[model samples]
Target: MSVAVYIAVMAGVTYLIRVIPFAMVRKKIKSEFIKSLLYYMPYAILSAMTFPAIFYSTGNTVTAGVGTVTAIVLAYFDLPLIAVAISAAAAAFGVGFLV
Candidate 1:
């Protein structure tokens, strides 16, 4: 019920999440399937966390969608990160004014 209790519970859960893996896997992993799963897990988790937030970030789905599309297009073209970010923000800002 208290904040300290919540924080302590969270800390215990986080510690277990990190420790359980190390405790379970002591030898080099030989399975390609498992290896690939581990390799892609971070990206999958990051996308899962990030994708939904993108649509709600600007408080307007239209502007957020425009910005997301702009970012995706620029990233696909392998544009510089700075250019992609600024262009996305500008696109979102301009769309915000219109919509």
Candidate 2:
């Protein structure tokens, strides 16, 4: 398929996957357990999707680890998102160059 068609199809699929659940569940969910589960679902899914990429995005796992640690430290300190990202990339690059 052409790039535009592929992107359109993927966007439709992603949109449907996210929207269908809300369309089906018109009533407010009453179960606290289920409500809590739904509240945390996005964070859980995001972490699942992102954590593995962080470990493999750099050329080496060691550098990736350094980057991940740097990001976590910066985030813990409530740094801005851009600062966290730039510092993480710099840490990874610096470590990669030195090693």
Candidate 3:
């Protein structure tokens, strides 16, 4: 496919992936279990994205990884997102440069 067509198709698929879930469940979600599940969905997604970086190293959890530990601890305070990103990036780069 051409570059434009490839981008368009990927965008359409991405939108559909997001929309289809809610559209399919809107009417069927009438139970407390589902409601509670949906309520925590955003937090769960955030945790899923954030928590892994802290614990999982190349293939294992490295508690001594100061960069990962620092990032995770700061994340609990609700500081600005950019600060967290920069700190994590700096931690990684600083350690790599020194080693």
Candidate 4:
């Protein structure tokens, strides 16, 4: 198949996946539980998508991985987030030199 056709088909499928859910849900009664579920769904999805980057590594591509972990730990203890992130990134780069 041509590249244009492939792109078009993928785009159509993507649109349908997003549109069908709203169309169906709009026709039905949404409970408070369902409303809350929908409200927090994007954050859940984003976290799910970002979760793995906190650990896995192929080589020394370490900053995004360990940096995220460090940021989370420090933030949990009420540390300044920007400082934690900077420290994590520098630590990762420094660790890469040792490894």
Candidate 5:
């Protein structure tokens, strides 16, 4: 198939996926449970997509785990994002050097 055809198919699928939800739901959602699920869905999806990559990013699970732990601990203490990131990276790099 040509690239244009592939692009068109992808665009159509994306459009349909976005449109179907609106077309099916004509009124405001009222269920508290469903509302809570929807509210947290994006964070859940992002974590699902991102969390596993953390484990494999350093090419060594031990370093990756140490980095993840460092990041989590720093985040728990409300450290700045830059501090958390740098500390995690340093922790990973230091572990990678040692192992």
Candidate 6:
């Protein structure tokens, strides 16, 4: 297929996937469980996408693991996001240098 045609088809498919859900769901969702699930879906999806990437982001799995643990610990303590990120990166870099 031509590149232009392929791009157009893909765009249409993507648009339809997003649009059809809105078009079909005309009524306000009433169930508390369903509403809660929808509210948290984005966070769940983000974590699902991000958690795996964290393991492979550093050059070595060991370094990545250290970074992830550091981040988790800092986050658990309610540290600022910047602090968590910096500490994690520093830990990963330090571990990388050692290993």
- The TM-score leader among the candidates is 2
What range of 10 consecutive residues in model 5 has the weakest lDDT sum? 21-30
TM match of model 1 to true structure: 0.68
Q: Pick the winner on lDDT between candidates 2 and 4.
A: 2
Assess candidate 1 and give its lDDT: 0.94
Determine the C-alpha RMSD for candidate 1 after optimal superposition of all C-alphas: 3.1
Q: How do the predictions measure up, each by TM-score?
A: 0.68, 0.75, 0.56, 0.50, 0.65, 0.67
Assess the local accuracy of residue 39 in candidate 2 as a C-alpha lDDT between 0 and 100.
96
Q: Each candidate: how many clashes?
A: 0, 0, 0, 0, 0, 0
Model 6 TM: 0.67
Residues 4-54 of candidate 2: C-alpha lDDT, one tens digit per residue: 999999999999999998788677678999989989999999899878888
- Report clash pairs, candidate 4: none
Alpha-carbon deviation at 86 in model 2, angstroms: 1.1
Worst ten in a row by lDDT for model 1: 20-29
* lDDT per residue (tens digit) for residues 9-60 in model 1: 9999999999987888678889999999999999999899879999998899
Per-residue lDDT, model 2, residue 6, is 95
Instruction: Encode model 3's per-residue lDDT on 1-99: one tens digit a residue.
Output: 599999999999999989998787555667999899989999999888866555555333433275676677778887788897678667766666555
lDDT of each: 0.94, 0.93, 0.72, 0.74, 0.94, 0.93
Give lDDT tens digits, candidate 5, residues 60-97.
99999999999999999999999999999999999988
Between candidates 1 and 2, the TM-score winner: 2
TM-score, candidate number 3: 0.56
